[model samples]
Target chain A: MKNIKIRRLSKEKLNKPALHRPQASIESMHKYRTDMYEGMIAETVVVRGHGGTNINAYFARPLGPGPFPGVVLIHHAPGWDEWYRETTRKFAHHGYLAVSPNIYYPFGQGAPEDVAAKVRAAGGVPDDDVVGDIAESLSYLKSLPQSNGKAGLFGTCSGGRQVFLVACRTKGFDAAVDCWGGRVVMSKQELTAKYPVAPIDYTKDLSCPLLGLFGEEDQFPTPQQVEQHEQELKKYGKTYEFHMYPKAGHGFFYYDRAAYRQEQAVDGWNKLFAFFEKYLGTTD
Target chain B: MCTGIVENAKVSGSGKGPDGWYPLDQASVSYDHPDHAQSGRAIIIDFLNEAVGPKARIAVELTPESARNLVHAILASLSRGEGEGVRAKDEPPQ
Candidate 1:
């Protein structure tokens, strides 16, 4: 933390907030996977999201007819881009029907970087809107004929906090995964009027079985914050598993970024798959 | 890091953006996860024309060391009165 900084916001900044356009014209999808692996069909589509809005979303699922478990993949602070779509495919390859909605649609279809900046300027999506959108995503998954009725939610960065919030605020998710989400345990000063309550406060209401993946060195939810969250979960007798990898930080799963930690990211993915399988599938 | 709260400052004049030059009115600063910077942590400044769009601005993400240097340089330049040709009274783009 550099001590050389100042805190001052313009009145205009307070009055005219930045916004994200949660919209995108779904482009055609092609077979990005290898030929040997031909068990999934992925597509770009629109979902009936929060406020009854038609939001752009990516969907991928197995080719078979049997009902597969569903999982909603929430993107991080970064705008919904290639990685999120690929992650959706990854879930589909693992036998889960996955969908990731472009929550930035409200901010318009620009470069992902620009869209992210807009959302950040707006102080991230409102938690209530996030919950509503996630609920819509869950409903959409359940409505799919190929869905098994059981669904899980997985998110990274700020998206991770959304996963925890959805599990607590709504149902339909059989399991939840939080990947290095910062701000779950926000400081008092961090709590502003727009986002006043901390996600930790909702721990008691976290209905679904939860799995938390964390970076031990992550400053946002530092090792101390993780411990605090665990204490609350323990106090509530919640069923959960937490894995904090050493030498890892936020966005460790972002292979394209510098933070990508191969060993840690691989292990995190393994945990995610294992956790989802346990709750969303019949383990024999 | 979550980067937590972002600070905004009043600004004037224009910046060259993707859509050409646009009037920039505000600058938002924060220490957060950068969009493209390789650094795990960096101080970022977004000179924005909110009236236009998010793309209507200049954004910079600098490492702590570089940001400190930038601040010092900015202060030194300001103290040395570098505002002479900034507005340039009647000069047009050359």
Candidate 2:
């Protein structure tokens, strides 16, 4: 069997590059071979979210996977939109099962923009509800047959803040990435009935290695605020890495928006994959 | 970045939305990232009627300059209407 596998690999190499190459390292995650078979399935499915409510989620997974790490994507305050679906697929293309839950499902369904506006009007989703929903998503990912039994968290903007909150509040995640999450360091006056506690307060309970990517120009979580968060993490002796891009601002990873910064975003994504690989294990 | 700052007010008016006209009962104003505006951020205004449904709403995202212009226009129009003997009442129209 080993000799036959080697021969197949050799034959594939001679024909052209394979579409699904073995994930050897961070660099391998960026490269794709042309000749190899690559298939993925993406769709919207219902998952039990916070308070046992059945919420809609976009799920994507690679085909024919022996074992694959999982990632739960938390949508930004913009509600669940196309960018999130595309991003879920992007993670699948990289050999990981990805799921993005519509945390704003209770707000009603329509164009994402409309629903998000409704959520915003209601002062955003409660932190506890989001935490519950993400915990459920983590469970859903782990329950999959193809799962390698490891999962990571990734979120941008408000989703970023929620990822940090979830990583601190829950257990079992191997890694987490917070991309320019704002309001992590909220003032007493900024606290509302929904977000009663600052996420920074839970720093000591962080359950996994964390990677944070921030834009220096971001106003909500200013460079000073990021510094404050790092200090707290340091006080707890937590394992983490944070990168601040010089010319970028909040939501810099959003390619469809004016905030998109190509060079910084590319570097940030590379750092993200590397961090996840280090903590969650490479997709083989 | 999500500013996470929102201001709400009880408003009595009418707005045209995706489903046509509806009675608006609330207005929310904020300065944050726009859902459709091309800019990095903008002033967002949402006129909504919760009694109707979430879809019974009108939303606008405008640049700071545009928002300021809109504010000035509203004030100026109100002033002109009052000059033309449009009654100004202490309370909203019934």
Candidate 3:
């Protein structure tokens, strides 16, 4: 380690917490897989998750499946944005039951523009509450007759951060895939809002395998920061794999945004599917 | 807030497979001094925009079973050269 004394800018102004929308509409609607790669069953349902949270979840069953594997998709910080739902549908197009919950509920819901102000005014919800809601959703999936009782987790942005925290806090998930969410580390001052779990303290207790995908160009938490975090994981002896996309930025996996890079997103999607197949597949 | 984990198996380093430990890719690791490979921390600065403009990225890879192992290895290695204080204590003869 270099004995370099990196000067801390003591007079620098503290960054104001970014205002964020707390939740999205739980519109229970159904849509089919656009093009058939085959074995894709699509449907929408309202699920009572996390102490009866009204969550809009989507299920995609295998084409000829008596029963199929399941995946729980957690949405990013902007709430259940449009891209989150589309991603859920895409998971349905694949051969798994995918469920996504708008973690920012109970605070308020409205257009993206309004929710942020309301959330900030309401003092934000804790991370643990969201995690509990996700856990309840998992239990709900397990109880479903069509599901094989095995579930994996996937998330983008804030959702990505949640996946890692959940993997560390609970052993229920068979595997977890986190796409560019690294909010696991929060400072004392940053603890103004409530959180369901403490990722920093709990990361070492992680039992499940995890895969983290990051855009090399993410501005919020740079890839280097993410890599540094990975180094932290080395101390805990928890297994994880990381993929850094060369030319992608934050929300690069999102199809609706200009930031979307189809090639990179597809590559990530392929890797995600393969990872699930390896870890969540049933030999029986 | 940087928090992450890198776990590899004992034989083949992967999360899904059976238990195994990862042998650090020494070749890829950067050390302050070549002769002091195990002593100082290695750093790698990668480009942030690997896809477009080249950005800087810095990383260090090390092996220990758990967080405990990581802390011990880092502290010991920094204080002494390589495995000086890191050697397992010898058992007393019966």
> Highest DockQ, which number?
2
True contacts kept of 3: 0.04
Model 3 C-alpha lDDT per residue in residues A1-284, reported as the tens digit of each score: 01111111111211321222212111211133457346655666777756666865655555665366778888764455566667777766555777776665564555432342233223344567767878877887788777776889998766777788777777788889988785566555445445534466677777677887777667545755665666667667667776666667666776655567766666667667777877887423
Q: Least accurate stretch of 10 residues (summed lDDT) in model 2 chain B?
A: B84-93
Off by over 4 Å in 2: A1-28, B83-94
**iRMS, all models:** 1.8, 1.7, 18.1
lDDT per residue for candidate 1 within A207-278, as digits (tens), equals 899999888668867877877787788789898887667778888899999989876776667667777878
Model 3 chain A: worst 10 consecutive residues (lDDT sum): A1-10
Model 1 chain A scores worst on lDDT over the 10 consecutive residues at A3-12
Point out the higher-scoring one by DockQ: 1 or 2.
Answer: 2
Question: How well does candidate 3 score on lDDT at residue A168?
Answer: 76
> Candidate 3 lDDT (Cα, whole model)?
0.56
**Candidate 2 displacement at residue A148 in angstroms:** 0.6
lDDT of 3 at A200: 61
- Expressed as tens digits, the lDDT of each residue in B10-87 for candidate 1 is 899889876688898888787888878989888888888777776776889999789988976776676579753443
Top TM-score hit: 2
Give me the displacement of residue A164 in model 3, in angstroms.
Answer: 1.1
Please, what are the lDDT tens digits per residue for candidate 2 over residues A1-284? 11111111112322341323222334555656777788899999999899988999999999985499999999998879999999999899888889999999999988898789888988999999999999999999999999999999999999999999999999999999999999999999989899999999999999999889888788868878987888788789898877667778888888898899876776677778878878877555
**Higher-ranked by lDDT: 1 or 3:** 1
